[model samples]
Target: MIVWSVLIALAGAFCMALGSALQERDAVRAPGHSVARVGFLVHLARRPRWVIGTAGAGAGVALHLVALSGAPLTIIQPIGVTGLLFAIVLSALFNRTRVRAGQIAAGTAVMAGLSGLLLLFPHSAEVPQLSIGTGLGLTGAILALGCAVFAAAHWVRPGPRVLLLATVGGAALGTTSALARVVAANAAADWTAVFTWLTPMCLAAAVLGGLFQQNAYRTGHFAAAYATLLVVDPVVGAGIGALLLGEGLPTTPLNQVLAVGAALLALGGTVVLALARNRNPEALRAVADRDEPTATKPGNASPGARASTTTTSGESR
Candidate 1:
């Protein structure tokens, strides 16, 4: 069962990577004014590629849940770090670009650090539990933090904005994972668990996470955004698992030191990946040209002028 869980989790990671690549391709074409808003998702829903990408991500989540049923979060969550590597390859393929050596090295660092940190978490067989009050508090805190980060992203440049959005997205998804554990445990003991506050909160967090992810993609930095999200998700999930589900870390001093070092390594790797360039400039230019306004009204300009403007815009990125 454990071996099967590992295989399933790996497959889920690939699906997630494919979904992110497809979604990012369309997200970059969304109107700038619509980003980070409800309308942004609504707009994306109209695009076939985006819808297909969403389906892929949803399928990945389903497979993750199945894997979780057979293995502890400690094992299952670390497997998700492999998604970053898959995402890099998929993004390069979509853009018709080569994956640079620096990107490969940085991505390997991220996966290694994150996997080490997750593996260090001590798994518990204790069934997860969450009271209504605790569930409400968790939901409120996650929503508040997500909103604050979303607002902050507006003040930053495109690069920083992607980081900020991805952070919130990752946190929300982590919370979703933690809550799902509670709900799944309870439901196994009692079917009425579906009516618990945790069920709704888990769904809400998943939706919130998805929204922030799309916003991150809108910045057109797939490597930075995806890398940050993957790194943050497992860290946040492991922390929540420890705090809320009794899956604490090892108490040994050596393990503690190693855990801290692993965390720092993961963070450092995330920063390096963020600084690395992965997408092709021509792909970005194509997206810009496609999104350029077609109207001849004031500020819209003719096709030639719009082409020139799109070229400049792509260059600025």
Candidate 2:
């Protein structure tokens, strides 16, 4: 069962990575002006690449749920770190460029850190019977955090703003995963019970998480935003598992210290990837051009220029 769980999780990671890479192109290409407008999704929905990417994302979500059903959150969620490596590689390939040494090193560091944590500490988790009150409390907490993040994003610099959004978005996404396990298990026994239970909350959180994440992609560096998301998402998942699902992980003094160190190491890789990507800006250039800090004034650029800048390579593969 562990073997099957691990394999399924790995496969899900690859699918998510592929979908993320494809969606990065769309995120940047989405209009900066009308983001808050209702038509934003409608516009993206019409794109061929976005549709294909959505398919990959949907499939990945399904695979991840299966993996979660069989494995512990600590074991399953961390496998998603591979998605960052996949996104970077795929992004480079799409741009017709070679991967940078810095990218390689950063990816290596992320894998190493995640590997160390998983090996050093054994984690076990099972979906528990959460009360309605307890579940509502968890939902409220995540929503409060998201609200704070959303407010902070408007006041900060673009770089930090993107990071904030990405972090909160990851947390929201991780909560969705935690709640999903609950919804699924309960749904198995009483089909309609979960509908009014965690299901609606999970879906709502996923939408907001995805929205913030996509916005971060447009506002932040591609590698930076995605790396933050990949590293943070599982940490959030692990935390949610403990808090919401009653899956307590290691909390000894030594374990606590180690967890912090491991998290920092994984996070440090984002910086390395960002630095490595500085040299080959073309990979993110298509999207970054529109997101650049003071690169071009919207007023100065002609309508045609805006259109050209937003024109994604539209690589659908």
Candidate number with greatest lDDT:
1
TM per candidate comes to 0.84, 0.76
Tens-place lDDT per residue, model 2, 15-103, is 88788777767766676531233355677788899889878977887898899899877688667567777777877776567878778
Candidate 2 residues lying further than 4 Å off, grouped into runs, are: 1-11, 34-39, 61-80, 116-126, 275-317
lDDT of 1 by residue, 135-251 (tens): 889889999998888766655656566778888899998999889888888888998888877888999998899889888777767887898888777678878888877788668
Lowest-sum lDDT 10-residue window in model 2:
308-317
Off by over 4 Å in 1: 1-9, 62-80, 279-314
Q: Give per-model CA RMSD.
A: 4.2, 5.5
> All candidates' lDDT scores?
0.79, 0.68
Superposed Cα deviation of residue 316, candidate 1 (Å): 3.6
Error of 1 at 80 (Å): 4.1
